[model samples]
Target: MGIHLHKLALVGAIALGAFGLAACGSGSSDSEGGATGVENPTPVGGSWEKGNFLPVSTFTDRCVSPRSGTDPITGSAYADVLGTRQDENNWLRSMSNELYLWYDEIEDKDPARFDSSLTYFEELRTFALTPSGREKDRFHFTEPTNEWLSQSESGIYIGYGVQWALISSEPPRKALVAYLDQEDSSLPDAITRGAEVISVDGVDLANGSDVDTLNEGMWPAKSGESHEFKILPLGASDPVTVTLVSAEVESDPVQHVKVETTDSDRKVGYMLFNDHIAKAEGELIDAITELESEGIDDLILDLRYNGGGYLDIAAELAYMIAGDNSVGQSFEHMQFNDQHPEINPVTGAPLDPTPFHTSALGLADDSLKGYPLPTLNLPRLFVLTSGNTCSASEAIINGLRGVDVEVIQIGETTCGKPYGFYPLDNCGTTYFTIQFSGANAKGFGEYSDGFVPNGPFGTEADLPGCEVDDDFDHLLGDVNEARFAAALNYIEGGDCGDVAVKAFAEFGTSNRLLESNVSVPKEISRSNRIMVR
Candidate 1:
C-alpha cells in the first residue's frame, strides 16, 4: 500500500526520529551497557557507505510492466499490493493508518492523540481496527509490542539514566546528544581501543609457497599497514596468536554419493548443502552429475547447514531432480489486486497505483504450478536434514516429497518454513509476507505443520569427538543401523513380512514400526514366526 498524500509530508521527519530512537545505547553504548545513568560518548560512523535506494520510477515501471515479472514462486495473493486497484484510496488509507500507528508508537510523545503504543496489543483490536476492517485477521498480526517499544524508544531515558548514575543529575527532557551522536565514527573506535595485533606469513596449503592474500578480519579494527595475517581471532574466548609458516585453504570437503556401495551395495548419495548457494551451486551440480555418471543407485542430499537464499536457483535445481513429477503440480498461486480491478474511485481514472495479492495452491486454472525434475527411479533416498535447512532448500524437499519419493529423513527436523515470500519493496524498506503456502501431493498446503522425519534421527545434544554439525552426518550415515534395516530389506527385493521380521529382530517387538506394520493378533513369539510372515 502506498502512503496517503496526507501522511507523506510528515513521513521524512518521523523516520529520522525513529532512526534516532533505535540507534541509541547500542550504536555506541558499552557491550553490557553501563548502569542506565552513565555519561556516554557518541558513536563514530564508519567510512562504510550505504547502498543506493531504488528510485520510485523503478516501481512505477514495474507496476506498468505487462510481462508479469513478479516472482512466480511467491504465488498470486500478493497481487493486490503489486497491481493497480479501483479502491486505491482505501488501500492508501490503510497504509497510512499503519504508518501512523507505527510512528505514534515509537516517536509520537504527545499522548493526547493516542493511547499507549501497547494499547494496540489485542490481536482483535490491532488488526481489526484497520480502516476497511475487511482485511482484519486475514493475516496474523501478533508481533509482541514490548520488544519493539524497548528497541524503538527514544534513548532519552537511557541517556538520562547514564547521566544520573555518573553525576546524580536529573533526567533531561531530551536524550543526551553526546552519547548518541552518530555523525562521526567515534564510539566504535573507543570500544575497540587497545586491541592486540600480530604478524604472520601466508602460504598456500596445496603448494607450500608464500602467497599474497586479502586480510579482512573482524574488529578491534585499526588503521594499519596491510600484512599477511596467518590467523586473526576477533572474539575468541582466549585469543591466541600463531605465526603462519604454512597456511591451509581448501574448499569445503563434504561429498555426496548416489549409493553406499561399500555397505551391501545400497544405492545412496550424499549432499552437504549450505545456505550460501552462490558459492556452492556450481560445485553442487558437478557433484550430482558425477554421481549419476558413476552409476550410483541411491542418493542422500545433506542440507543441515543450508540457511537459504536465491530461491530461484533452488527451484531450478529441484526441477533438475523432480521436475518431471512436479510439473503441472501447483507450488503456489498469486492473485493481483483481487478485490477491485480497474479505474480509481477517487479520480475516476486509472488506478493511481496497483498493489499485488497472493495465496496458496488453490483450485484455479491459472494457479502458478511448480515444474518438478524427472525422477531418478531409485528405490529409496536418504536425506540429511537439520534446523538450518530453510526457505528455498525446504521448497526443494517439499517439492520432491510431493512426488511420493520415499525420503528416509535423518538428522533433526528441518526448519519448518514452507510458506513462500517475494521481497515486497515498499517505501524505503522491504516487507516479506507469507504470500503462498506450498502444496503437497493432494494440493494441500504445508506451511505451519512441517515435514517430520520417518524415525528418531539426531539428538539435540552434540556427540563427543565428532564435529558438532556432524549430527547431520550421523543422520545420513547412521541409516546403515538396524532401524533402517527393514526399509533396506524391502528395497533389496524381500517380502514385506521378511523385512518386518528382520526389523523386529534388530529393533524389538515393541518398536514403533513393528507395531504400526503388524495387524494380526500376537499369536506367537518372533523366533517361531514364519520368516515370510
Candidate 2:
C-alpha cells in the first residue's frame, strides 16, 4: 500500500492570555454529587466554557446516552452538542449557524445523525456545503492525533511500501503493482512494479469466494502483520511465493527529476512532484536550480500521483515556474463561509489573498528563507496529471493560470478539490473539516468535476492536451510512455497515433474493469484534502 502525507496548514497561534483566567477557575462539579477522591485527575488543556463542558463517559456509556438535552445556560433542548463544540473551534463557524447552506434541508433529512453520541467527525459527513453538488465537502475526516502529527513532521508510514493498481476487476479480480518505494530497504527484490498478483495468503485471487481474504492481506490494518503473495514478475512464466511484512517506510515525494532532449531537439525538464510537503520545497528548488543551469526550453511537471500538502509550497512552486509574471498576481483567493465572508477565519482579520511566494516557508531551519527562487520563465507549462492529482497539485495549475501562464494539462482529469482547512485536534483525533474554498486571480475555481484534457474542441476549463491512459508497460520516465509521449507529440506539432488513441479509448471504456473489486488500501487511496497550517 502507498503512504500518503496530507497537506496541513499549521494551526494559527493561540492567545494563551485569553485562556489564562478561564484555566485558573475550578471546573464545574458533577450535577449528581461531589467529586470522588481520585488522586490523579486528568490534566486539563485549552479554555473552559460552561456550554462546552459535559460529563465524560466511557465508550459503552457514551453510545447509550440520550440524543438531545437542555443546555443549563440557554435552557434550550439541543440535538447536537458535538456540533456545537465543533462550531466553537471550527474556522468556518457558519456550519453551525442557522443560515448554513444546507441548514433547512439537512435538519429535515436526518437530525438523529447530529446527536452527541455520534462523533463530531461523523456529524460533518451529513452536511452538504460544496457548490459543485458532488459533495466535495464530504472529504473532511479525522486520523489519530499522534499519527497525524508524526507523519506531518516526518513522511513515514507503516505499510508494505508498494502501490497497487486494480487493472482488471472481472471474476478473477487482477491487481498489478504500480510502484515500490525505493527508499524502503525492507521490500524484497521480487516485489517489483508490474508484478501480477496470483493469490494472497493462500486465497486464490482468481476465485471470487476469496475476495475478502485477498483484500485483507493486501491492506492489513496494522504494521508487522505478514501476508504471503503469489506473484509473477514482468516476464516470468511461473508465479513465485513471497511473504511481505508491513513496516515503517519513508516516502520520497520527488521520485525522479531530470532533463531530456526531445526528438525535435528541445530540452525538456521533467519532475515527478508527488506531494507538497515541506521537504518538497527544498527538493523542488534544487531540481529547478539544476534545470535553470542546463537551460531547458520547457518543463513537464508530473503530478500523476500527488495527493497534496502545504499551500505555501504550492505558492512557491507557482512563483518558481511563472517567475516575474506571478510576482504581483494572486496565486489563490480563499473564500470562507458566508457568515464570515470578509474575514480570514484563522487570523480573525480581513481576507488577504495568498500571492506567489518567492521564498520557502515553515522550514525548521532558517536555510532557504528569502532565497531567490529559480525560474524557467517559460510562457507555457506542461502538467501531467491523473485521477490522483489533487488539492495543492490542482492549486499549482490554477495558480499558474491565474497569472495567465499557458498550462497544458496532460493525462486524465484531476481529483477536483478546491477547499482547504487547518486540522483541529480534539480528544485524541485530529479532525479535518473544509473551512474555505479558493479561486484563482481570474475568479474561476468551479472545476469540481475535474479538469479534463482539452482535445480538438475545448471546454472553458479545459487545456490543450490529450487524455492518455497510464502506460504500465513502460516505466514512467520513459519517453515512449503514453502520457509523456502525448505531451511531447503535442509540443512538436505531431499527433498521437491511432494505436495510442485506441488503447486509451479501451482503457476509458473499461472503467469498471479497472475499478477495485475490493476496498483500496487507505494509505494509497486516501482523499485529497488540503489541511491549512
Candidate 3:
C-alpha cells in the first residue's frame, strides 16, 4: 500500500528520531551526581529536548544527483551508482537507524562505492536478514511472519516494510517536519511538498483529525508540480534539515484533471488508484462524483501506481462499479495461515489457534448481502497499467478483466505481488508479510508477474474541448457557459486528437506498451478468475 506508508507511524518515526545525538559510545559522562572516579564517562541513551521546528520558506530548489539502474537481464546498462554523497548516505543511514535496523556488510562487488541512500537501504536489508527478534517490534508489515521470512530471504521489495513510532513524550505538542532539498547537479529539481498532522491528541493521521489540522501552507511547489508533506515541532529553526520520507511523485493523487482542445466523441474517465486505503478511496469516490456532476461518463481507471491497502476498500469500489453484478460474482478471495503454528513471532507466546479468511469484499451473512451492485454494462474500460500496480489493485484489474469487462490496458506490466499481509508486532518492531497466501478470484492466482495487460499499452485517450470551465477559471462575474458546453460536448462524443491524449498522458500513462517486448513467463497464468464478494 503506497499511501499506507504515510499512514504508518512514519511521521512518528521521523519525530521520534527527530533529535540528533552524538555517537553513543563516544566517551560521554553519565555521572549520577559527581564525576565518576573513572576517567571517561560511559555514554547513555540519546537525549532530546523540546526542539521547535519552523516552516521553511526558502529552499535550495536545485536538482538532485541522478539515479542509476542496471539491466538485470543483459547487464548492458550497468553504470556506476550516482547520488553517493556522504551527506545523502548519512541521511539514509540515520533514517535506517531510526528504523532500528543496521547496515549489513557491503559486498566487495558492489556496483559502486557505498553512498548514503544505498547505505540506508543496506541497513534495512541487514535488519531484515539478521533481525534480533528483540528489535522486530519497530517495523510493520501486512504479510504474516512466515511469509515475510520467506519473501525477505528471496530479497524482494513487494510489501513495503515500514515502521512506526512516537515522536514526542510530552503531552502531544511535538511535530515532525520534512524538507525537500533538490540541489544536486545530476537530475532535475523534482521535490515538492504537502502536509498532514498525525495527531492533535495522540490520534492517527488516518482518523481524519490529524490531516485536517495539518498546515498546508508550509510547503510550496514550482508552479503545478506536486510536493510531499510532514509536520514539525512548533518552532524548529531548521525546517529544511528535517526530511520527510515519501514515495515517488507518481503515487500521490488518485484522480487528475486533464483538459484539451480536441473533440473526440469518447468521454473517458481516467482514475488512478495507487492504494486500497479507505481514506484515499473515499477521496477518489468524491472526485468521481464531482466529475459525474460535471457531466463525464466514459472512464479510464488507472491502477498503474497502486501498491495495495485495505482489501475492504477495493471490494467496495468494485461493487460500486459492478452494481448488480456483484451479487452473484466472487470478486476475490483471501487465504490465511491455518497450518503449522510456531511460537508467536511477536510475543513468543502461543498464537491464536485459528486463522482468518475473507473475500476481497469480506463476507456476507444471510441477513446482509455483500457487494450487491449490478454490473454497469459500461463502455470500454481502459485500465492504464505499469509494473507498480500491485496487490489489491492487481486483484481488481485481474478480477474485472475475467468478467468480460472491456478492461483495455496500456502499461508495461504489473508488480507480481498478490498475497495479502497480516500485521504482526513483536518486541518493538512490527513484522509484516508474516502470514498470507495468494488471493485471486476463481482461477487467477498464479504468481509470476501479476496481470500482463493485453494489447498495446498506449497513452490515455485524446479528447479536445475539455479545458477548465471558463466559469471556474475566469474571474468574470458572468459564467463561462461556453466552456462548460465545450466540456460537455467532449464528454459526450468529441475527439480532441493528440492534444487531448497528450494532456491525459501527463498523468503518467504514456509509457505503457500495448504489448511487451519481453516474453511472458510460463509461471504466470493467463486463466481468468472473476470473483464477486
Which window of ten consecutive residues has the lowest lDDT sum in model 3? 520-529
Q: Score candidate 3 by TM-score against the native.
A: 0.38
TM-score of each model, paired residue for residue: 0.39, 0.76, 0.38
Give per-candidate clash totals.
59, 7, 78
Clashing pairs in 2: 7-309, 8-531, 9-531, 9-532, 9-533, 10-533, 421-532
Candidate 2 at residue 301, lDDT? 92
For residue 252, model 2's alpha carbon misses the true position, in angstroms, by 0.5
User: What lDDT tens digits, residue by residue, belong to model 2 across residues 1-533?
Assistant: 11123212211222200000011111111111212333322322233342232222111011111124442222455222122222222321222221122223332212222323124334534455444455545455556545665555445667677766665565656677766655344666667756778888897776546555666677655689899999987557899989988777666667667788877899988887766665677878888999899898899898877767777778988898889888888999988666566766455667878889877663523577778888878888999887777778888898899888998988887767787766543333445666677899999887766777773434446777777877666666767777778778777774444325322211111112324322112231123445343
What lDDT does model 3 reach? 0.32
Sort every candidate by lDDT, greatest first: 2, 3, 1
The reply for model 3, stretches above 4 Å from the true place, is 1-253, 257-264, 294-297, 337-380, 455-533
The list of candidate 2 runs beyond 4 A from truth reads: 1-120, 125-133, 168-170, 183-186, 364-366, 455-459, 494-531
lDDT of 3 at 76: 43
Ranking 2 against 3 by TM-score, winner = 2
Best by TM-score: 2
